[model samples]
Target: MACAGLVGCASVAVTDDAITQRTAFALGVDRKDLTISNRVDDGTTSRYQVKTRAGRQYNCFVGGSISVLGRTVSEAICTEVGRDGATRPAVAPANCNALLKSAGKC
Candidate 1:
C-alpha cells in the first residue's frame, strides 16, 4: 500500500506530443521533421531517441511531475549523438550555458 502511494505520487505520463515539441524546440527544427523512438521510462522521467529528416540523431530527456494541483512537464533537453556515440548538447555555445542553467544542469 505504501509503495503504491509513493508510485502514484511520483509518476507522470509524459505525452508523445510534449516530447516531440520539446525536442523540436531544442533541436531548432520542425516537429514534423523529427521521429521519436526507443523510449525508456523511469519514474517521472523518460528518455527517447530522436531522428531528424536530415539524418541527425539526438537523445532527449523529458521530466514530468504530478502534484495535488495538477500535472506538468518539468524539463526537456536534447543532445546530438556523434557517429562515435558521444552526446553533445545540441544548442549553440552562445545559448548552451543559458539553456543548461535554465534546466538546472549547470
Candidate 2:
C-alpha cells in the first residue's frame, strides 16, 4: 500500500538512438562513425559504452524522470575512458577541452 505509492507507476525507456546521438554530439562525430559497445538500463537511468572509428571510447550515462502522465525528461552526460580504465572529461580529436571547460568539468 504505502510502498506501492512510493514507487513510480511509469517506466522510462532509453533508446539506443538517443544514446548514440548524445555520444556523437559530445564527441563531435557523426553517428555513422560511432559504435555502441554496451548498454545498461536501470529503470529510469541508462549507461552506455560508445566507441569511435578512430579507436576512442567513451562512457555515457543518461537518466530521466517520468511523470504519472507519461512525460519524461532526460539528461545525458559522457566521459572519455583512458587505457588505464580511468575516466576523463575530454575526448581526443574533438576539441573537447573547450567543451569540458564550458561544462565546468575541466
Which candidate gets the maximum TM-score versus the true structure?
1
User: What's each prediction's TM-score?
Assistant: 0.75, 0.67
Q: Please give the lDDT score at residue 99 for candidate 2.
A: 62
Q: Compared with the true structure, what per-residue lDDT tens digits does model 1 show for residues 33-79?
A: 99999988777788889999999998888887565656677556877
* Residue 36 displacement (Å), model 2: 0.9
> How high a TM-score does candidate 2 get?
0.67
Candidate 2 stretches with Cα past 4 Å from truth are: 1-12, 68-73, 91-104
Please, what is the whole-model Cα lDDT of each candidate in the order they appear? 0.74, 0.68
- What are the clashing pairs of model 2? none
Q: Tens digit of lDDT per residue, candidate 2, span 1-106? A: 1113333321344567767776677778899999897677666677788888999888888774444555353555778888998877754445547766777666
Q: Which residue runs of candidate 1 sit more than 4 Å off their true CA positions?
A: 1-12, 94-106
Deviation (Å) of 79 in candidate 1 = 1.3
